[model samples]
Target: MSPGDGNDDDLYGGTGQTRTRLPDGGQGDMYGGAARRPARSSSRSLITVVGVVVLLVAAIAFANRGNSSSDDGDAKKPDTSPTAPTGTKAVTSGFAHDKQGAQSAAANYAVQLGSAEMFNKAQRDRILQEVITPSRVTGFEDTLDKAYSPEFNTNVGLNKDGSSPQGYTFVSRTTPIGTKATGYSASTANVAVWCSGLLGMAGENSKNPVTNSWFTISMKLEWTGGDWKIVTHSQKDGPAPVPGDERASSSDEIANAVEGYGGFTYAR
Candidate 1:
């Protein structure tokens, strides 16, 4: 049941010792022609019955302990390896070279779009302008600005300035699983990013708890303004796996880690 609700006492009902007195009637007389058979069991029979019971109890205890240990151990293991890319490089690279550069670009862009800074209007605008087509950049910035308004920030427990409260850490980190270019042309590409993200806050007395989500983000990329710029992008939920054994990191640790690690600019 619901993790850590087991007890040894419940397993072996009361104490190991049980006193069952047989009735002094027909069954007793059938064995010894007396209204009551001797109150005492023969030493041999008593030992035999006790031995059988002890063996049964021991077997049950061993089985329960083994099962419990297995469950506990399984809960602590982490699943960190990335999953295989569903689409082949050949399928993705119709126009561009099916080499490291395209892969790297897709990966880097995915990370940038998935960063925590994307939730801030000013930061998001700068990122969008840097990573999107010049023609579509204004529209993207406007849409995102509207999405991350004061009410949305408040709902996510961020201050009016979009900063986390002191001692609290907001987490929004994405790990790319794989990149696929669905359609590629000489100057444009449609890239799909399969990713996993940790989103929410972690801290003592924090209202929000850290949570994981899996999603696929697809972007229509145009080679404009000296780089690949996203013209359009969309996201859909996961092909996620079962949870793993890593101990939950505290809010302060999560915050420190995020600040310490610098994000990448991908090209492949």
Candidate 2:
């Protein structure tokens, strides 16, 4: 199916978090704005990093692959990896002071940065406060305020004010598949998180049906205020896997699943 239409490049990208190099050797617009609107193709291509979703797909495939020995030879084993669920909201603190800590921070920050809440002004401000480096919070807030404008909201299937319509739910969630620390020092680090994402409006006859995307987010973090806080971040499209043959769910099913399932606080 179509991944919806229009200039919602910011909706998928850093959500005003990533920086890009412009044609004139200027910095990229974090999200789509008038300054960047005329360069739609180039800007969107630079910033439209896809988001993520649930991990049950592989598990379900393993369980239902059948018992035939012929198929068994090719059947993959189920992933039995242990998870590091925090049992807390994504707005967490007190991460360790090492490379692992940087990975953990990147994972959690990806969740908040890519959430539906980021589309709303108040919630967005609150998120910036929690995840952004103290010295950079004001700058992030200013850039994002203009990034998530009413026009941007409407383009992405939300109301002009960035709220879901009465009967629909706007979904924008990110799930980190894994994280890696690329650079590390005593007080600074760079990490990348491979993630899967889900976005769109879920409801009957919804033009923007919830869809999946794959992307990687790269973040530069610093040990600030006793915890890792984002200094800057950027995203790129993939290392995506091949699509499976499973039938897509109905809009109602997608909506129900989103409501029923709560998000996680990720760790390295």
Find the 10 residues in a row with the least total lDDT in model 2.
Answer: 55-64
lDDT of 2 by residue, 1-268 (tens): 0112222332234343222122332233222222221221222232233221111000000011111223322323222211112232223567778888778778877776777666667766766677778887776666566666787667556798877888887666677899999999989999888877666666776655555666677777999878898877666666777777566676677777766565554333
> What local distance difference test score does each model get?
0.43, 0.56
Per-residue lDDT tens digits for candidate 1, residues 1-268, read 0001222122111133111222233221122222221222221122111111100000000000111122333223222211111111111112133333344455555555555566556656655555556676665555445545677555555686767777766655556788887887767777776766555554555545445555565666766544565565555545666666466565566556655543322223
**Model 1: CA > 4 A from native:** 1-102, 259-262, 265-268
> For model 1, what is the C-alpha lDDT against the true structure?
0.43
